[model samples]
Target: MDGDAWRPDLTSPVGFVESDSEGDLEPSDLESDVESVGTSVISGPPADVLEADPAIIVAVGDSAISAVAATDLDVPVVPVGDVPGLSAVDPDHVSNALESAFSGDGRVRAHPVLVVETPGGGRERAVFDVTLVTAEPAQISEYGLSRRDESIAQFRADGVVAATPAGSHGYAEAIDGPLVSAAVEAIVVVPIAPFVTRTCRWVLPNDGVVLSVERDEDPVVLCVDDRTVERIPAGEQVSIAADGALSTVVVPESADGRD
Candidate 1:
């Protein structure tokens, strides 16, 4: 019940006869009706809000590029959930996507990192020189932040969160990073266990925009899944985004020449 959504208790009116009033009144049942009639109000681009707009544009790289925009226009995101005629499909914005994809220098050197408190409250200095090989940080680096996930992990820095649809099921979901429905249309970006992490996870960046985290405090640190690399020491920078990469899927629908 924090940000995006919440559950509420429903109540109904009831009638009763007072002992002084010589009348027999039928008492109304409120419990069962409340339980049966209540409905969850799915947050973000509610079906009704999306009904007003017609275009639901989602770019490649699993970024919710058009999600908020479409929602703002009252257009339903492609597959925020299932719709009778809705189907999961590839994003139409590919030219730019391909440009970003190929632009991958097989390297990213952007954002400047900063130091913060150590998880154990020690003066342990840590850094990260993460290389987005086949492994990850590929997408996160797309933002070209100064020294984002590209750095290795260290004590001061707990870890870098290279979030995606595949990894989002866990903590990402908890942070309200958009849920990946059965259909593939959105991606959730979440940073886990960041020593100086923000109170809440930020939204995934589009292929064009950049996500830069400022080091407001003295020192900061990010360990890679808890492993220390010591590259992103205090006062460094970082970058993130989807590298020019494609994860092919073999859905039966695609074989049928459809989504």
Candidate 2:
């Protein structure tokens, strides 16, 4: 399946009648009638977006490289994460990845980071590369913005995820978002458990898209790289922009079959 594939057909519909708890869940008695669902593997972004410039891409923690791009010195090592976005499968692979990045021409791939401003006058940031804006129970969520007085897409769903190409392989992919190529120059916005049957995921241009969320109910949470979590209180709003860049380490061409 393509990375951007949407499956609203597998989602349950919203009912008009309100219930006490969480309200209006699909009737449990209709479970058997809904039919069992199947799964499909979504591929990553298209090949054309991958720019091969024979550059050395290093995988470093955000703390080490967040303020500036590390292009002056050689990156000796990289810490790997078990999570798909930052995971480096094995020791040999890690070594090869570093070697490939080091031996290649001196250049790096850049992935955008999110700059989040909270209602409390506080701010947070993320690189390497997605920020999940969602609510619990996977249902009570809606996100939208009226830019320059024009209302953009008002996404109503259980959750909304905005991920960059480098981070697309992680939570974004797990939530059925497209696996954007790390080299792609776009951001993927996917709705988790959408109520609308024909809801479409957005592959927005990365010219600094801002997502604003506001409501009168409970606060919606923001998770940055699954590490930092913030809540935007009722009536207040939080804005997320595709800002900054995260440089990554690349796997070498010579280590093709080591896995």
Candidate 3:
């Protein structure tokens, strides 16, 4: 979809039809990104999805290891806005995205954990400091649900989650989340301190836009794998687009370059 990958077949009588239809169906139209929960990856994802190319993308203000993990796996990650050939379906801008991100060459700050207290006779109070790696709450308007404003207005807004199978396990156990298999292609939407209980912790549909974290509090604590990386804050608001996308590269035993 990034490059000029198609052309009219000059020899076929039905040449123009496929080309004409393709111009209408672009990569930009993809809004939903699904999650596959686990520590070990599936040999091959199911036949349903049109797999995304393994990318090296940096979430601005994300942890340093965010980039580190991508690099170690030899995935060519740039920041969310860095890749030049990105589809319009991608909300983050790609134009100035690269240079702006490269400036953050070092320092991949980690997320913090908060100790929230339920204020007596008041809404729960969560005190946190914003750093580079954590989540916050945002409005529903940001996700193109404005047309359904009547329905959305009833709900309070929220943030994104970087859930792994291990993390999902903890969240589910702590917040009454559904017991989704670590091997399943799933991520839970356990709404943090939600206004309504019914709308909480939905096993997200495969084709969903898991809403981005908000920037309400100056900082929010991200619950990373059972440990607290204190004083982390929320950055750009974006959906929980878990890159469940994996590849089957041969894992060579350690020594040197043996490919």
Candidate 4:
């Protein structure tokens, strides 16, 4: 997605969602700052702010932006705190960031969302990545990767992670997975502690990517981002694909020099 595709309109009201841990920065104080710019402010929790349908949302922390991203809302978000893969501004720069966003001086980057499905019609959406790992520590298991019914690779490993391009910079990168560009419509698949000394990692298309537990010596669990969703029985298949993208405002002053 091009950075200039979307820009906030300062003429309309904007929403504000802040983290609870921001001790000195009260909601009213932030609201006052936003109002200082002569723009109407819609101040409340993420859900409430979304309900009002503000022109844009300003999330104040990692947790705050994560909450907004978890929702199915498609509105553009202006991250105001520490958010990975985003050009997020400091809390003190909220006013400047808002001006940049509304004045069309900021760039908008789209982060793809992953849709994960399991047997018996279970489905979930992930903003970052989805992982399938052994429930027990250090337990080896055989897993298979496939796309469009064609086998990609089968190997014995502790687990596997399928991360979005934005998510590739985190856990996946730490495990030797390639860091994918946000503009690339691909998923990064990396084996976790493979039994073999030499293993292969993949950057595959987002659609029709499947991971199955070929041989589960121990139980396995599925994780969407940070939270464990449920245990996966042996032989069950987990499917993942790119669904929609999250639009984020990227201000030049806040960018950490990452693509």
- Where does model 1 exceed 4 Å of error? 1-162, 174-176, 180-187, 191-198, 208-230, 251-259
Candidate 4 stretches greater than 4 Å from native: 10-12, 18-26, 37-45, 61-63
lDDT of 3 by residue, 1-259 (tens): 0112122111211100011212332222221210211111111111111132222222221232132232223232222211111111122333223222223322121111222211122111111111122244442211111111122212343432334332344433455555544344444545444445476445543223323323434454433332343432233322232332311111111111110
Per-residue lDDT over 102-140 for candidate 2, one digit per residue giving the tens place of the 0 to 100 score? 344213334566666666776666554434345555536
lDDT of 4: 0.80
The most accurate candidate by lDDT is 4
lDDT per residue as tens, model 4, 1-259: 5565456665667888887865434456556655765677787788898888877887876667667777779878877766666667777777777766666777777889888898758787777788989998889888899999999999999999999887787788889999888889999999999999899999999999999988767998998887688888888999999998878877755757254
Clashing pairs in 2: 57-249, 58-249, 59-249, 138-158
* lDDT comparing candidate 2 with the true structure: 0.45
Q: Regarding TM-score, does 2 or 3 come out ahead? A: 2
> Candidate 4, clashing residue pairs?
none
Q: In TM-score terms, which candidate is top?
A: 4
TM-score winner between 1 and 2, please give it: 2
Off by over 4 Å in 2: 1-89, 95-107, 128-135, 145-150, 251-259
lDDT tens per residue, model 1, 85-117: 122223322223222222331111111111223
Q: How does each model score on TM-score?
A: 0.27, 0.57, 0.31, 0.88
Residue-level lDDT for 68 in candidate 2: 24
